[model samples]
Each structure stands twice: as C-alpha cells, then as structure tokens.
Target: MVPLKKYPNYSSWAFLAVMAVGALFCSTVIAGVTGQFNLAPVGIFCGLLWVIGGALCFWAVQAEQDLAGTGLRSMSVSILLSFFSGVVIFQEPTLLYFSVPAIACMVIGIWIPASKTKSVWKNWRSLLSGAIFGTYLIPYKFSSLGDMEFLFPFSVGVCVGSVLLVAIMTLKRKKSFGYPKIPTLFAFASGILWMLGTLAIFWAIADDGMFGYAVGYPLLQLNLVVNQMWGVFVFGEYASRHGRIKLTLSTIVILVGAVLLTLSKM
Candidate 1:
C-alpha cells in the first residue's frame, strides 16, 4: 500500500477520548437502570435527554458548521454509519444485513474521497478499523443474549477479531495504518466492555432507571462522538486533521453531551 499523503494536523484526536468515556458511563448506567427497573419510562427519558444534549453539543462545537461540507459531512457519515445500530438491535438481525449497508455508506461517505489521496489498501484498513471501532462504541441491537443463549460465542468473536485487527496492523505494517498501539486496546476493551456492559445494563435496568435511561442513551451519543473523533483523528476518519482546537472542542462536546444527558436523567 502506498503511504497516505501526510497532513500537518491532528487536533481532532482529543475528541475520541471524550467519546470513549461517554460510551463507558452511559452504557453502564443504562444497563444498570433498565435491567433493574425495566421501565418503559427510561427509554422515553433517554430520548428527550439525547435531543437536548445533542443540540448542546452542536451548539458548542459548530462555529462554521455547514450542511454542505466539513462538519456536516463527517457528522452525516457518523449518523449513516451509526444507523446500523438499528439493524443490530432489531430482533434476529444478521451481521451482513446491518454490516454491509453501514460499511457501504461509510465507504461512500468518507472512504472514496479519502482514497483520492491515500492508497486503496490504506482505505481498506481504515474501513476495517472504523467498522470495528464504531461497533465497539455504539448501543448495538444485538447487544442482548438470552439465558445460556449467547455470551461465550460473542466474547469469543470479540477477542478473536480484536486480536486479528492488531495482528493485521502489526503484520501488514501499512504506512497509513490507522491504529495506534495502546489506543487500539481501547477498541478491544470496547468489545469486551460491550459484551459485559450489555449484560450489566440488562441486569441494572431491572433495578435502576436513572442509571439506565439518563446515563445510557446520552452515553450512546458520547461513545459515538468520541469514537468518530478518535477513529478519524488517530487512525483515519471523516475529516482530515484540521487543528488542535477543532479536535479538543469536538472532544469536549462529546464528554459534555454525556454529562448533560446523565444529569438530565436525574
């Protein structure tokens, strides 16, 4: 694979850290409450929390936000890709059903143009990293597992894939390979976290609505926000690294969004 064209900036990376934290908290909390209380109310509350919190994130971060380009483009990519969550969450949805379309949109939305400057191999690498990264970050539909139904297999898949991605990155040694050594651990952590987190949320939501509804839904946004930020910033992503301020602010927005949602739940 040819080396990707070099860039002068990497400020956006900060946001990824922000989003990861959000995913952890929100998913954990939501699981706690919904598993415990099983409240229909929790979902409704989350809906409201997300709306206001998302708006605030947009307000704080989008100074030059435009529909046609830059901010909108990346966000659009994230949304479209995230839309796969619906597929995963739906009852008995297959991997390809959700994965294919989501992957395609991501390719069109971000990868094609990116390919112009970078090699095809690098583009594919980004695709792999991003897809996995996104998976770990979101509130996936397939998050559930019936009694004795799906825990071991799921964990096996996660551990395998994570190890594979790392091995690929190491063996391939593609110059523009997006993953960082340690940060990629977060991706693995996310996979394991999602599995355990899902069960935890499942249990918690049975007793804890505040933790479930308020913390979980907004936390979804939080995870995605940082996921998007980091995926793009560290490895490769929707936008090329513009500068530090953009990255930092984007990161801040993700964290704040999670915080706001969690608080509103209270």
Candidate 2:
C-alpha cells in the first residue's frame, strides 16, 4: 500500500508505474479479444471486467480527495489505449498528426499532480478502472447482434457481476445490505443516468456507423471536465491558487486533446 504523504517517493513511482503497465496490458488484451471474439462470451467477460473496474474506481475516489483529477488521469490513459486498439485490432483509420498530438496533450495534462498526498495504489486503481471502462464499446462494434440485442446480455452480465461482487464484499466486511436513504436514492438516480447514456450510445452507434462510436468516445471523455469541477468547486480538491491554476491548464489541454481526437476520427 502506498502511504499518503507530502510527495510521492521512488516506491510510490514504482507502484504507479507497475499498476499503469498492468492496467494497459489488461485493456490491450481485452481490446484484442473483443476484435476477434463473438459478443456472447465477450460481453460476459467484459461485464466482469467492468465490475472489477467499478470497484477500483470506488477505491480510487475513497483514497483521494481530488476526485476530478483522478478521474481525468484514468480517462486519459483509456483514451490512448482505446485509439490504439481501435486502429490495430479493428482496422479503424486515424490521422497520425491529430491522434498523436491529442494523446500527448492528454498525457501531459493528466501528468500535473492533482493532490499533495496522492496514493499510488488508488491512482493506479482508477487507471485500471478506466482501462476496463474503455473496452465497453469495442466488442459491441464487432458484434453482429442488434443494438438492443447485445445490450440485453451485456446488461445482464453487468448486473450479475455487480451483485456477486457486492455480495462477496458485504460478506467479507460483515456488513448488512443497508444504506442511508438519501445516498441510496442518489445512487439509483446515477444508475438511471448511466443507463440512459448507455442506451444513447447504443442507438448512436447502431444508426451512425463506426463514425458515431469514434466521435462519441472522445466527447464522453469530456466528463473529465465535469469531474474536475466537482473536485475543485464542490469537493475542494485544490485549495491553493497555484494548484487550481494547474488544474485549469490541465483541463484545457485535455479538452483540446479530446477535440483533436474527435477531428482525427472525422
């Protein structure tokens, strides 16, 4: 476990590097499999990854107060991995100039440290979560199943995987399946929002060809901006003026990168 301290040490850097590598490898393998496999098995398998990824995301937010920056870093990693997998395995076309610059901008932007006490393990967990989240659409693009058809099994897999994980976690923690009403309501609301957003993606992809997927992928990454706002304004992730400036500049870079990526696909 990485100790939350004034600055990350060499061991901290090592942990982050190893975790990032592992996350990247997992994403690449998933992408490769997605490009070649049928949706039946792939959807099930990918759903399981999502559950693991979701858990990592939870851990990440719990470990750090700068929720937005953490989310952005993870998303930035996914952006690069997604583009690579799309082109290599799925034969998607991309202009080198735009794509390379976009990736560079995102990486540089995310490199600006978000918190004083960054936990390497938690940060890497977020990266792994983003990696898994990034693979959500890869299999769907290759599947012959209709949008709704694929969504059904995929959704089922997600539910099953989530329930199993939650149950196991609860058992290990010796906790009851109970929560505060307000938080539970908010969680439900978020679930609804997620479902709607997902359905929209499915519809867009089904209607607009791979072009839609490519375009939507980067646009959705704009959520990083929102997360940052929540971090700064709502969560007060950065109190110092200098830190806030760094976060702002990083957000701009990330947006620019996202736009460039979108244009590259078009």
Candidate 3:
C-alpha cells in the first residue's frame, strides 16, 4: 500500500484535540450503555460499536501517533462521563459528592499536554472509534446473561467483528495473507490480556450492577498511567522537563481522581 501523505508542519494541539474528542464520544457511549444495562442479546450491537471504535482509535494511533496523549484523553473523558452519567442518568444518588472531585481532577489532568502530532484525519478517526468503544458493554450488562454467558457471546461478537475488519483491510490493501510469527504471537498475548480485562469488568458488573461501574470504570482509567509510562520511557514522548512535569502532575491528579471515583462507591 502507498504511504500516506506527509505533513510539512504537523500541529500537536490539533491532533490532541481530535483524539480527545474521539475519546469523549467513546466514553459517552460507555456511560450511556452501562447506565441502561439489561439482559438481552443487545450486546451484539454494543460489540459492533466497540469494533468500530477500536478501528478508529487505532487508526489515529497508527505510525507515530502519541500513545500517551491519546490514551490520557480517552481515559479522562471516560472517567468524567462515566461517573456523571452514573450520578445524573443512572441515578446513583450516592455518587454525587465524590464524583465532583473525580471529575475535577480528570478535567485538570487531561488538559495537560503530552505529545506532538501529524494527522487531522487520524484524530477524527480516533474520536469516532473511542465513542463506539465506550458503548459495547451496555447490552450485556443489562442482559440476564450470567458472567460466563455474557463473556462468551459478546467476546465472540467482538472477535468475529475484529477478524472481519482484518480481512477487509487485507483485501483493501491487497496484502498477502501472512502474519509474522512473532507479531502474531504478541497479538495473541494481547488478546488474552484484553479478554481477561473484559472478564474482570463483566464479573464486577454482574456482581454489583451500576455500583460495579462506579468502581470498575475508574480502575480501567488506570491504563492512562501505564500508557504514559510507556510514552515517556518506551516511546520517548513528553521527554522535555516541562512535559515531564506536566505528565507527572497529571498522573498524580488522575490517581486522586480515580480514588475519589472509587470512594463514590462507598
């Protein structure tokens, strides 16, 4: 496949904005779906949405995309909207006081800059992707599927959708059907990790309902910290003294926010 066009002057701010917007949309869906959880096969629709979101999000992160910025933005949005909806829409009356601080910290943390960038289209794609991913859990949560039952069919849907996307991409690029052994193995490993995370969340909600969301969602945002570490140490993102300080403070704040969000469950 031909390489994408090069941008003579890439704008980090623009890229971050687009990525954050995508994250916001994705988080909105997550909150909305989980708030409306029920026992039906509707998880298939959520799975499809998640597949779309994942495609767009990865598209933004492709080829030198700032993992830290994109991840932080996505998590910030998810943290805020997830709780806001829990309190307002889902009527989690107990969460209001604690959620205020959590939301505040997320707002402050996400605003801190993290990386430079190169593509507007990539950001847009990420935005759409994040929005869809945020919603995939709703149907299964609402469904009467036992923990394992929800895990099986929803996971199947996600896998099938993802495989179809891969097939479509291969066809579009006219790439030969071959996977590098190491990369395929790594991908399988990643798949296992993702499945484990999904199962953990499903189990939480299955056990506790909306209260599960109160705690689990914030825990999920902890990925922001991990992603930032990868960005700073592995990818050399936000390497400058100023950027490092920002990221450090952001991490602290995000942690506090997560704590507050978890406390809301109390």
| Best-matching candidate per lDDT | 2
Judging by TM-score, tell me the better candidate of 1 and 3.
Answer: 3
Q: Clashes in each model (backbone N, CA, C under 3 Å)? A: 26, 0, 13
Q: Report the C-alpha lDDT of model 2 over 84-159, residue by residue, as the tens digit.
A: 6666767666776887788788777877755556555656878787787777677777766665555545554565
Question: What is the C-alpha lDDT profile of model 1 across 199-252, one tens digit per residue?
Answer: 554342222233432233224433444444544555444454453345455455
Candidate with better lDDT, 1 vs 2 = 2
Best of the two (1, 3) by lDDT: 3
State each model's CA lDDT, in order. 0.35, 0.60, 0.57
Q: Global lDDT for candidate 3?
A: 0.57
Query: Candidate 2: worst 10 consecutive residues by lDDT?
Result: 1-10
Residue 127 accuracy (lDDT) in model 2: 79
Q: 30-97 in candidate 3: lDDT tens per residue? A: 44566533323565565556667665555555543567766765665566555554555545555667
Better of 2 and 3 by lDDT: 2
Of 1 and 2, the candidate ranking higher by TM-score:
2
Error of 1 at 216 (Å): 6.6
